[model samples]
Target: MNTFSIKPTICFDTGSIEYLKNIKNKRVCIVTDPFMIKSGAADKITNIFKANKVEYEIFSEIKPDPTVQTVAAGVNKMRTFKPDVIIALGGGSSIDATKSIILFTVKILNASGDEYKKPLFIAIPTTSGTGSEVTSFSVITMGTTKFPLVDDKIIPDIAIIDADFVKTVPPQITADTAMDVLTHAIEAYVSTNNSDYTDALAEKAIKIVFEYLIKAYENGEDLEAREKLHNASCMAGMAFTNASLGINHSIAHTLGGNFHIPHGRANSILLPYVIKYNANLESGEETEAGKRYAKLSKILGLPCSSISEGVKSIIVAIKILMKTTNIPMNLKEVNIDKNDFLNKLESMVNDALNDKCTATNPIKPSKEELTQLFQEIYGE
Candidate 1:
C-alpha cells in the first residue's frame, strides 16, 4: 500500500460550515481562542453545531503560540467532554492546540510507554492562510521553546474553508500569513528531500502566491483573492507537509521557539535574506537554481536573464510586498534588541542545526555561515 494520509473532506465557499452538521462523531469539542469568538466565527460554528443537534463544548482560551499548559488544560476539558471529535476553529495556534488536546485525550490518556491514540479532528480556518486545517504538524510553545509535534494523525478529518470567514482579516495578518504561504512553497520546492508529488504541488502553490497574495493583502474583502490565497496556502501546506521545509522555516522555528516571535512574521523577515544567502552558493549548475528562480520570476511577470538575476528579482519583489503590507523587513523592527540577539545567537544556531527541516536545505549552512546570515537579517 502506498499509504499517505490526506486531509479530511474539504468544503469551500460561503456557508460551508453547514457541512459540520453531517459529521459522524458524537461529542464535539471546539478548541479555539477569544479572537475568533470576537470575530463572530466561533458563534457561527457554535450555532451550526447546535443546529445539527451534535453535542458540543467550546474551550476558547487558547493563547497565541499556545503553551503546553494551555494544551494540557484543553486536554483536561476533553477528558470532561470525552469528545469523539475535535474541532479546531481558528488560526494555527488554535488548530495546533486542538491536535495536542486530541493526542493527550486519546493517545496519552491513561496510557504508557509514550504511546498515543489520536481522535478524529475537524478544522475550520477563519484565516485564509496557515493551512492548519490540512496539516499534520502542530507547533506548541512550551516555556521558551516552540516544539513541533509531527504526525499524520494530527491531520484533520475535515477542513471547512470559507473565504467569507477570511473577509474580516486585517491587512497585516493577510500579509504575514500570505508570506508564510510563499515561504512554505519556496522552501518545499528547493528542499533536497522533495519528491515529485510535492514538487508539483509546490510549483502550483508558488504560482498562486505570486498571482494572489498581494491582491489579498490589498483588499481583504475581495472574495476571489481570498479564495485564491486560501487555495495557495493549502497547496503550500500540502507541499511542505510532505517534502518538509528549509532553513528559513528551521531558523524561524528556532527564533520563535526561543524568543516567542510570531511564526509567520519571523519567516517573513527571514525569507528574503535566506534566499539571498542560499543563492550565493556555488553548489553546481545542475542544482535547482534555474527552475526555482525562473518559475518565480515568470509568475511575477519579472524578466531576468539568469537564475541569479531571477533570484535577486524575486527577493526584491518580496521586499516590495513586505513594504506595501507594512511588514518590517528586519528583526530589529520587531523589538529584538541587538544585544539579546547576539547573545542568543549560538543557541539559536544550535537549534536551527538540530531542526528536522534543516536536513533538507538546498544549501546547508555552516555555523559561521548561519551567524553571518543572522547578522545580515538583523541589519537588513
Candidate 2:
C-alpha cells in the first residue's frame, strides 16, 4: 500500500518567527550552533521567550558533520533541562543533531519502561537548505560514516521558515543548499515510489530553484528570493520524505561521509552524473527515468523534443547551473585526491548499493555501474 502525508505545519513569510511567542510559559531548550549565537539569530528566538517570560536553555555546541558524541552531549542537556519545548534553530547540522538527541533521550529516559512524553518540537532553519525542519530524517555521524535515520518521533511539530533568519547566509552556502534543493526535488520526482501528490510538490520545488536560487546566491539580502528558496526547500522536503530518494543520495551520502565534504555540495557535484546514469542515454535505451528527465527538461524550457535530446539538455543545464553557482564540478575541484578516492572506490560502491536510499531508486545499479559512475564523476 502507498500513501502520502505532509507533516509539520510550515510557517513562512515576514515575521514568521513571531509565532515563537505562541510557545507559552513552557520551558524551552534551543539546539543550535555557535554561528547562530554570533549571528544573533539565536537571540531572535530567545528574545521572544524573554518577552513572554518563558524559561529556556541553550545548547550551542553543535558542529558540522555532528557526530554521535555531539548528539550524546545534547542528550545530556535534554535530560537535565527536561524542557517542555525543544527548538532547533540553525542549519541542517543543528536540526539533525537535535533530532538525534531527542531519539537518544527517548531510549535513555524510557530504559526502565517509564513513559517519556516528547516535547513540543519546533524547527527554525537559518538557511534555505536541508528541509530538515519538515522531514523525519536526521543524519548523525559516527566514525567515517553518516547515518540517515528516519522516525515518526523526530519530525518537527512546526517549521518556522521566516526569510529574515537567512538574510545573512553566505553566497557559497546559498549556492550549495539551493542546489541541494534541486537534487531533492528531482530525486523525489523520479523516485520509484512517486505519486501524483509528491510529483506536484516536487515540480513546484524544481521550478522555484530554476527560477530563484541564483538570485538569492548573488544577493543574500534579496528577501523575495530568500523566501521563495526557503519555501521551496520545505516543499522539496515534503516530497522526498514521502517518495524517498535514490542512488543519487546513496552515493552522495557515501562520498560526503568519506571525504568530509559538505552534504549539499556533494549532492550538487554528483547530480549531473547520476542523472546521466539513470537516463541511460549512452546505452541508447529508453527508460521511465529517462522519460522523467525529459519531462523535467521540457518543464525548464530546454530543448526536449526527444528523450535523448532531453537527457542531454538536462545534463547541460545542470552543468551550466553548477558553473554559475561556483560549485565545484568534480571531486578534484573539491580537493579529494584521486588516490584516496580510487583506494576507497570499492567500499564506496558497496556502501552505495547497501544504502537505505538505494531501495527506492527508479533503477537498481550494479557494482560495476556504480564504480564507473564514480570514476566518470572524478572528472579530468
Candidate 3:
C-alpha cells in the first residue's frame, strides 16, 4: 500500500535548444555555473533566448554542494531580475541551486508586501544524474549542516534533457556520478517507503546503469551511451525522490558533510558494505529490503545462489566496478585519517542513527554496530 506522484512538463530533444526562444516570458533568469559558461552551454542557451526575443539574465556563480549563503545569493539575484521564468542549466549543483533559488523566491513572496508571486521555473540538465529537474527535494548545505528542502513549489515546470551536455564529462566524473545514479536506484527499490511506481522505475534504472555506465565512462563521445545514462540517472532520481533513501544515504550525507568527500564516491564505496550489513538481518524483519537487493543483484548479472549469496555478489561487483574506475575503496585512500574516524566514531554513529533516512533502514543498526562498520572501512 504505497502511494506516490510525479508530473513534469514535456521536453524537446537535444536539438531543441531553439525551444528557449519560444518561451513566452518577459524576464527569464538562467541559473548556471562558471564552468558551464566556459563550456559554451550558457552562451548557447542565452542565444536561444535572444532568438526568441526573450529578455533574460544569467547568474553563473553557483558552486558545487551549494551552501545556504550561495542559494540566498542566487535568490537575491533572482529578485533583482524579477524574471517570469528561471532556467537552470548545468549539472546537479546548478539544478539543485535552482530548486533552492525558487524555494527562496517563494519564501520571499510569502513574506513580502507585494501580492504578486514570482515566475515559473524550468530545468535544462546538462548532467545525467541528480534528476533535480523532476524532483521536489533540494539538498542545501549550510555551515556544517546539510538540509533537505521538500516542497512541490520548486519542482521545475519543464525538464529538457540533452545528450549534448554530457558529451564532455571527464571519465572520472562519469564514473562517479553514474555510481550515484546506481545507488539512488538500488536504494529506492529497497526503501521501506517505496511504492509500486518507484519500484518499476528503480528496476529500469538499475538495468540502465549496468548497461550504460561503463560504456559512457570508456567513451564519453558516444551519444547513445550518454543518452542512456542520462535517462537512467533521471529515472533513478525520480525513483528515489518518491521512495526516499535508506541508511546508505544517511551515512553518506553525514560523511560527506563532515569529510568533504564527493557524494557519489562516498555512496559507491559504502553501498556494498551497507547492503551486506542489511542482508545479515533476519527475514520477515521490520522491512524486507533485502529481497529488493537480491533482485537487483540478479538484474546486474551478479551471482546469486541464494538471497545471501546474491547480496554478496552484488557487493563484490560494486567494489570491482569502483576499482576499474580508479575510485578509492576506503576512507584511508581519500585522505581521511583513521584516527579522525576513531575520534568521531561516536558522533558519526549518532548522527547517522538520527538521520531522517535511518528510520527506513530494513535493519537499523545500533550505535555499536555502526561503529564497527565505520572502523572496518576506516583502515581499508
Candidate 4:
C-alpha cells in the first residue's frame, strides 16, 4: 500500500517570519549555530519574541553536521529551561541539530517514566537547501560518521519559509543548496517507493530548480528566485520524505561523513554518475528509472528523442549548471588526496550499503560497482 503523509503546515511569504507574533505566552527555546547567533540573524526571531514579551532561551551550540555530543548538551540545557515551543533557525545543521536534541530528549523523558510533552516545533530556514524544515530526518555525526535519524516524532509542527531571510546568503552557498534541491527531487522521483503524490511534488521541484536555481545563485538579492527556490526545497523534501531517497544520497552521506565535504557539493558532484548508473545508460538497457528521466527531460523541454538521450540530458544539464555556478565537478577540484580517498574506499562503501536511503534506490549496486563509482568520482 502506498501512503502519502506530509506533515507540518508550511507558512511562506516575504514576511512570513512575522508568524512568530502568533506564538504568545509560550516559553520558547531557539536552536541555531554560532554563526546565526553571532551574526545577528538569530535576532530576527528573538526580536519578535522580545517584542511580544515571550519568554525564551537560546541554545547556540549547534555545529555543522550536528554532532551527538552537542545534541546531548542541547538536551541537557532544554531539560532545565523546559520551553513550551522549540524553534530551529538557520540551515540544515541547525534544524538537524534541533531535531536530534528533541528526539533524544523525548526518548530520555519517556524511558525515565517522567511526564513530558513534545514542544510545539517550528523551523525557519535561512538557506534554500536541505528542505529540513519539513522533514522528519536529521543527520547527526559521531567522529565523522553521519547517522541519518528518521522518526515522525521529529517532524516540526510548523515551517516558516521567508525569502527575506535568504537574501544575505553567499552565492556559493546558494549554488550548492539549490543543487541539493535538484538532487532531492531527482532521487525522489526515481525512488522505488515513489507514488503519484510524490511525483507531482518532485516534478515541480525539478522544474523550479532548472528554471530559477541559477537566477538565485547569480544574484542572492533576487526576491522571486529566492522564494521559488525555498518553495522548491520544501516540495522536494516533502516528496523525498514520503518516497524515500536512493543511493545517490547514500553515497553523499559517506562522502560527507568520511571526507568532511559539504553535503550538497558531494551530492551534486556524484549526481551525473549516479544518474547514469541508475538509468543503466552504459549497459544499453531501458529501465523504469530511465523512463522517468526521459519524462523529466521532456518536462524541461530538453531534447529527449530517446530514453538514453533523456537520461543523458539530465546529466548534461546538471553539469552545465554546476560549471556555471562554479561548483567543483570532481574530488580533484576539492583537493582530496587520492591516497586518503582510496584508503577510505572500503569503509565508505560499507556505509553507503548500510544507509537507509540505499534501500529504495532503483538500482541495487554491487560492491565492485560502488568501488568503481567512488574511483570515477575521484577524477584524475
Q: Which number leads on TM-score? A: 4
> Compared with the true structure, what per-residue lDDT tens digits does model 3 show for residues 1-380?
56687767746456755567667657888899999888787888877777778888889989888888888899889777777888899887888888888877777866886554757778888877777878887877876556667777788878877787788989998988888888888888887788789989999988887888888888998888898888888888788878888888888877887887878888887888788788774453433666677778887788877777777778888887888889888788898977787787787788788877777777768888888888776655
Evaluate all candidate structures by whole-model CA lDDT and list the values in order: 0.80, 0.90, 0.80, 0.91
Residue pairs clashing in model 3 are none
Best by lDDT: 4
Instruction: Give one digit per residue, the lDDT tens place, for model 2 in 73-130.
Output: 9999998888889999989999999998998897888895867779889999888879
> Where is model 1 more than 4 Å wrong at Cα?
1-5, 110-117, 281-286, 289-291
Q: What's the CA error at residue 312 for candidate 2, in Å?
A: 1.2
Choose 1 or 4, whichever is better by TM-score.
Answer: 4
Taking all chains together, each candidate's TM-score versus the true structure is 0.93, 0.98, 0.94, 0.99
Candidate 2, superposed: residue stretches over 4 Å from native: none
Candidate 4 contains a number of clashing pairs equal to: 0
Per-residue lDDT for 165-273 in model 1, tens only? 7888888888888888889988888887677788787778877877787888878878899988887888788888877788998889888876777788899999888
Displacement of residue 338 (Cα, Å) in model 3 is: 2.1
Which pairs clash in the backbone of model 4? none
Stronger candidate by TM-score (1 vs 2): 2
* RMSD of candidates 1 onward, in order: 2.5, 1.0, 2.1, 0.9
The stretch of ten residues in a row with the least summed lDDT in candidate 4 is 276-285
- The 10-residue segment with the lowest total lDDT in model 1: 110-119
Candidate 1 C-alpha error for residue 100, in Å: 1.5
